[model samples]
Target: MSTDTNAIGLHTSTATQLAEHLNILLANYQTFYMNARGYHWNVKGNQFFELHVKFEETYTDLLTKVDEIAERILTLGHEPMHAYSDYARVATIKEDTHVSDGTTCVKGLLAGYKSLIELQREILSVASDADDEGTASLVGDYIREQEKTVWMLSAYLG
Candidate 1:
């Protein structure tokens, strides 16, 4: 590997790739957060109180992760993609619409979490290769938390 480094001491080429992946992760998190917000607002059923609070918590965590991911991109000396337009262009997770059912909302959350895990795993691999421990640890933490979330959500659905 070339010793050439960016402002942060990472290889410039690897940082660029990591930034691109992180941007995709950011976009997905934005869409997921919005979906969670919608679920929190629109959920109706016997489980209303429980699900409403859970959705709020989920979105709150996602919003924090979105900011952290953006900051990591900046720390890599690359601009994070911020606009919704750019997110729409780059994100794999599509916007969920008019989904007011608790079951449906949980399903959407599952899908979103699955997508995030896959992308984060990719980021983890690249960060490992590039020796970017900060980014690697960040995504690793996200992956672990989300995996537990997926399990809990799955249990809720069942």
Candidate 2:
């Protein structure tokens, strides 16, 4: 094998591809996180307390993943995108500007979670193919957890 691989022994090209996917994930997570925060603060009506707390918990967890994802990109010898502009340019999860209704916020969150899980699944496939166990495991855990979240959120909507 060529010594031209990255520090973790993955080829530069493979690492680059992984990093690219990771960067996109990072952007989406950041946007999702911000949206959760907005929901937590703005949500009103009968389910307000419940949804506000849930959104807070969700956004806090997202903050942690945002850090982990950036670190992973660094591990692959790439810089994580740091600007809101970069996130806006790349993220598929749109910002929630004015949603305050409890049910509406829940629906928005469900949509974001679904999108994140889908993107993570794609990344998991790439990571599995490249033998990047770290990336695979990270996103695999995310997928599992978010799948459950999706189910619960759907039940909430129903």
The number of the candidate with the highest lDDT is 2
Alpha carbon lDDT at 2, candidate 1: 54
Residue 96 CA error for candidate 1 (Å)? 0.4
Question: What's model 1's overall lDDT?
Answer: 0.93
Q: In model 2, how large is the Cα lDDT of residue 104?
A: 86
Candidate 1 residue-wise lDDT, 98-145, digit = tens: 988889999999999999999999999999999999999999999999
Tens digit per residue, CA lDDT, model 2, 1-158: 67779999999999999999999999999999999999998999999888888999999999999999999999999999999999999999999899999988999999999999999999999999999999999999999999999999999899
Q: Give the worst 10-residue stretch by lDDT in candidate 2.
A: 1-10
Cα lDDT computed for each candidate against the true fold? 0.93, 0.95
Which pairs of residues clash in candidate 1, taking residues 3 or more apart in a chain or in different chains?
Answer: none
